[model samples]
Target: MAKKPDWSKEEQAVQAVQLAFDLSNDIQRAFRVSAALQDMSTADMVRKVLQLPYRRARARPRLTVTLKDEDFELLAQKYRLDPQDRAAIRHRVAEELQGFARNYLTDSGH
Candidate 1:
């Protein structure tokens, strides 16, 4: 003799109803058409719909800086650098200042 499996039919019915309600319009229509012709659980229909993955855009690296508001505004006005050349300009300026200070201090000998 084969034993019958115990099934929670009431919980399954509630889950089916909930999944049907949550389905998109196109999927819901497909589900309804499938349901009318055959015995299909809403969970199965939803699983079919869920085969399409949610696409997320790739993340890009970003730079952020923090400064005193007044100092930031003053620096912005003083430099007025082109966005593209700003890093290069800063590098050149720092190199030149270091060289000048080194020469001046060495020559002074005090």
Candidate 2:
């Protein structure tokens, strides 16, 4: 008699949901390559990509800032961020500044 393999609780739970799809060879190959590059299973990659919330593009106000080397270095160290990743740095700074403004306004009863 063949022995049955054991599965972890998480694996068992995931196994309960089964999704099957038929794709063209080219599409399948593309998904396989993408999944391999990301070091994830095809199913997991598909699930993650499908689960992301869709957002429509809209124009938003932008802020521009010029920083000296010393100031940039200080901000990078304080945020524990990479200076080369300008987009991430900008996003973090914007979020922090917005939060600070909100807190200050609330505290001042404005």
Candidate 3:
């Protein structure tokens, strides 16, 4: 089932357009992102581009990272999260960074 969007989300879409308009020196490029995000969830669109996981209920990806018990504990304490939650966050962030590098470095023509 498709989720209903809230008003704040709609506003962010508008804000994204405004940002594009402000930043993009070229009208065509500003219009391009604006149009592309139209009829789509702006939050999701930005998150996907930034490689962030969806905010909705999602099955956690299975990713292994070796961390010492002390390190894990420290992270959990600092973030006020359980070990599992900390692991999940770390994995998601790492994946996002990796994807960003791949997309930006390998795909973009500098």
Find the candidate with the highest lDDT and give its number: 2
Could you tell me the lDDT of residue 88 within candidate 1?
53
- Whichever of 1 and 3 has more lDDT, that candidate is 3
State which candidate has the highest TM-score. 2
Model 3 bad stretches (over 4 Å): 1-84
Which residue pairs show backbone clashes in model 3? none
Q: Candidate 2 or 3, higher TM-score?
A: 2
lDDT of each: 0.54, 0.73, 0.59
Candidate 3 whole-model C-alpha lDDT, 0 to 1 = 0.59
Write down the TM-score for model 3: 0.24
lDDT of 2 by residue, 12-104 (tens): 998786778898999989887876566666665676689853323213334467977777677788889886766777778899989997898
Candidate order by decreasing TM-score: 2, 3, 1
Comparing 2 with 3 on lDDT, the higher-scoring candidate is 2
- Model 1, residue 107: distance off in Å is 0.5
Candidate 2: residue 69 Cα off by (Å): 2.7
For model 2, the run of ten residues with the poorest summed lDDT: 53-62
TM-score, cand. 2: 0.38
Off by over 4 Å in 1: 1-83
